[model samples]
Target chain A: MKKIIYLLILCLTTSIFYSCSKDEPDTANSIFDTSAPELNSFDQWLRDNYVIPYNIQVKYKLEDIETDYAYNVIPADLEKSKRMAFLLKYLWIEAYKEVAGDGIHFVRANAPRVMHYLGSAEYDDRGKRLGVAEGGMKITITEVNDLIPSQIIYQEFFNTIHHEFGHILCQTIDIPIDFRTITPADYAPSTWFNRSDEEAAELGFVSPYASSLPEEDFVEVLARYITYTPAEWQAKLTQAGTTGSELITIKLGRVKTYMKNAWKVDLDQLKAVVQRRAYEIQFIDLDNLGF
Target chain B: MKKNSILTIILSLALAISCTPNIDPIFEKSASERMTESVENVKKLLTAQTNGWLVEYYPEKTQKYGGFNLLFKFDGENVVVRSELEPLRTDSSIYALKGDMSTSLNFTTYNISLHRFSDPSLNIGGGIGLAYEGDYEFVIVSALETEFILRGKKTKNTIRMTPFPTTIDWEEFCQQILDSKPEYRPLYLHVNGNDSLWVSNDETSLTMSYKKDNVEVNKKIAYMFTPQGLKLYEDFEYAGKTYSEFILQSNNNLISAGSTFVPRVPPATWLPRAAFAGTYTLIHYTNIGGTGTPYTKTVTLTEYDNKFLLSGLMPSLNLDVVLDYHFGKGILLARQQGLRYIGGNSLNLTSVTNEFGLSPGAFYIGQQVSWDGVSDPIELTWTDYGQYGSPIIGFVLWFTNSAGLSVGQYTTGPVDQRLWTHIKMTKQ
Candidate 1:
């Protein structure tokens, strides 16, 4: 009887342990919600233009995960954002489309995946950050609260967009060594802010901030040339007296050669196209998305 | 017989465990599924409100800044927000309810009235890292039809939104708050019956500070004014009890659950700061033998922001002295403020830059005789009469080479009691 009890108990316990369901996963995909967002007029416009054509996402609504928490920033104004979206497509996206080798395809391959907007500028002890690019994947534009159409070029917005975009291009193809060698001795990464614009011009760099690094210098020279008029370029040369001017001309020649050889981009043609589009934008209604 | 019974018991217990294996989940749906449903339901409830919702919003993670009453009316993807700060202004913006770990309410577009608190550019504390530290995105912790409990995504402060009544007027409600903001009061928190906490409620920082164990406990109790009373950021704990709302009593004093915010001095009248701009009669005595000389001065007082220039005191010097209205003392404390330029809102009014304080401490205090209600001041008595007792000369001023008040340091003038100690200004 003792043996019978022991065997029965052991068998029953074993059955209890082994009893389980052999079920497969109900769904192959993640259980997380991955639903499509409802598109309004502006969203749909962004989709047709930036999203579908260039595979880009213009995030106007401020998202904490998307922005840098290092600086305090607010959302861009809806009305201003609406105006800016149209202008960006016209002045920036379309400007590239008109110039690049494969046009929109070229933009699709190289352009930032996301373009974020902010109402106010992020100011630090040094100064304000107008635009910042992240790993050639995203670009954040600030101070969109005061976006005036005609004054876009005069202010940092257009120049900053071009500057950030130039960084993306340089990242794609490394900046030529000759360009870096022209102002290697003049580069002051830490104390570049202490140097004035006129002083920077006299030291073979386009702007004071351009003397920070070779990468920054490369982008600044490319962006300034693309945005500035021939007269504006000449004025920079004028300020860069004799030796400084000679260094700047050498650097500029290398930048032009790098763009032509590396990317097949004509700097002067891009400038003319941008300036002409900017001039014609005076009559175009920025608010009209043309959806 | 005992062996057989043990065998049966063991077998029965094992069989029971085998038959009843745990597989059923506690909830009917997954947490993500429930969160999605909850977010959808919240969105529906937000848009379904007839009047809208009243949000008691406190800025910053620590709740160290000010609190604001934000009225939110959600309709589809758009939300129109009104605030107590800007009573008349209304701003509309787009919002989206998306579920991540929890459902978040994001104000996607710029609503100036709402985003001003969150704007880092409007730095109240210090650094680019610190603004009001308000949140544009809020996590809906628990959503309901009547009320929604929220926490800021960045600020991480508990924010509550209750359904606003359709009958109540928003503008009027905001106006009532303006009338009831207790500015610069010597407040006390009555703890039980025997003990009380000496508190300082400052309007500038929206902070209440008290001393405990020789260390100052600065509590930034961000509060908003309602028609009923002042609503604190969260439940304020004192004497082992928590109180969120302070109701205004018949005595016009605010009372919380176990404590009362009893002011040492009566609150200033609800009259606007700009209302104290008019002519007045200056009565003063220059010498001991001098009678309270009444000088009829009919000059329209021009105001630059809150400070006003008061002249006619020491008329021989031809002074344009600046006077600050000390509402707590019911007196205008003489401030050594100077004006630099007057070109399109460029006129500066600072007490530190005493380029215009012709003489140091040459100003006088004009205390209101009565300040109990919301009305224009009727009479102002000279309170600095015997402040600085008998000096030979109250002030001797220096001018620049070009014959204007020069930039330099200035100490408040000795309001010499012996000279002009008896001045009474009655409003005309």
Candidate 2:
């Protein structure tokens, strides 16, 4: 009996060892591309400014996995990518750092993890696309190659970045319930593109896209306020007329309070910093950013 | 005892399988190592050719915008690309061989000619909200010394690359085709020395109209200039006639591929008078001299007495006026006395100032005929009135037959000292 038991134990042990051996086929690991991304000056800059500090990955190289498979898109131009990187750091990151009074905490905690730059837009079936934020983790900005560093174009792009960042912030901590109540009856949900910004403003919204949803409205107000100049804000308000202007003013007051109470962010201070950076963008020597 | 024997057999079989060494790789290297090797080999092959490679790229799967020729010069990390699409410009950008599911040749950096096909802002391939649905990343299917065949990762369109000999200037070759003033004549494709197929080119596309079972069938194919000759996007066949390749000969005739006797006969000006006599609408008109902007306006052309009565407001001048022109066999003359005010019914000859004249107000200017084609195709060379001296102006006018009147279909280039205007007209 002892001899039989010993044989049984030996056989079980051998079979287990054979199954778990290192020689077992591992096709998955074998095929994986273990190589790192090629390091260049632009990549190094991205690593230092985005990856190291904020743990954000700036993917300027075209990766099919990171893009929309339905629409054809190519990688951003290297020169354009470099220029855009400098602009983003100067305008978005530093401006937030200036407002939150922490060099890394505000962005590191709240910013999207991945920033994807595409040379062309991700045009949908409707023949319109600007930028898209996915699950508050990735933000894709397209048509970066054509950025001319002008205030109008920069404001449009800045609005997108801030809009996406707002979603990240909302994901971390929900927007104040009172903020959604301000424009409760006015959300378009769809068909907002058919309405002009002036028309949207008249309906107690800051921009046309803001009228799409409560969340988009909250973000649009914040983004537009931060990026728009004093003149532009006044023009929007004036265009909204008396009743609409009053409603917008009430909504802005609620947003200001919500930022201060919830995230401890000063909306007015953030706007000032962003506006100053926006004005100084054209003078920044994008090519020779001494990183 | 029985259980112990079964366990022993299983153990012995497991041990036997485990003791077998990894089967000797068919290739000395492992599969991963072989993949890496292949990637390197492809990279080396790309950069090895000193004269670079000509890439015949079809951007769309449906093959809508035809094919384009691009010359690629590859270095270690960068590729310099040139194309006739962007005339006389070469752009250097980054390229990489990446291992995804398969080894891919990716133009990771934006080269205008390479990326324009994927740019969403420009709709070239008739794909809504998409550029041409072109692929920037291509899977290297087969690589050889003379040719490399690649399939687009996204579009799945086949792209072929072959070594471009240093002796040939690709730009000059393309420019020659663009500059060649082939008589705007109908070409006759003779098959087996019996059946004939009519061929016509609209400068951008080739159209073959033939009778099939007593019904007129027209097959339009998009084509581009190749180093050798003209390459059609799709093969054409009708009534025992089949050809997709043509070599331009010195005599301005296209000889079909693999044939010593087959030639596409150029139009011999069979019908000229009835060509320009039609009611036409301006589809595209550009004023290169002034603002250099194209205008799409509803302008009517009434042809009578060998004269074209243009009774509509010229967008360039913003005037609602009547202009008359006399077109002959190979000469189109603009009568100075033909300028008139539609409301006043009086001649306003002095309104033809230098700016106005240069603005297509030279409506009174005559054009010297260069090439005349069947169906009243007329290419006219005129002089710009505003330019200091009499600068020779060249323009091409194409007309198509309609019910009772011939319509002016296409026009291009009153190339005034290098500045050219393109005007397209369709029968209304």
- The recovered share of true contacts, given per candidate in order, is 0.64, 0.53
What's the CA error at residue B148 for candidate 2, in Å? 0.9
lDDT (tens digit, per residue) of candidate 2 on A142-241: 8888777765334366688888888878877788888777768878775665565677889988877788898888888888888888888999899999
* Residue ranges of candidate 1 with Cα displaced over 4 Å: A1-20, A27-30, A123-127, A289-291, B1-24, B123-129, B182-185, B188-193, B197-199, B204-220, B237-243, B248-252, B255-262, B265-428
Global CA lDDT of candidate 2, please? 0.66
Tell me the tens digit of each residue's lDDT in model 1 across B71-188: 9999988999998877799889999888875889999889977887777664233323355678888998888888999998878888899998888878988988766664435455
Top-scoring candidate (DockQ) = 1
Query: Which parts of model 2 are misplaced by more than 4 Å?
Result: A1-37, A152-155, B1-28, B123-128, B176-186, B193-222, B233-244, B258-428
lDDT tens readout by residue for model 1, A1-291: 667767877777777767755455657445666778679888998898889988999999887777766667789998898888888888888887898777878788889999999888875433356899998999998988889987776667788898999899888889987777777888888767656567898999988779999999988888888788788889999988898788888888888888778777777777889888888888877666464
Worst 10 residues of 2 chain B by lDDT: B397-406
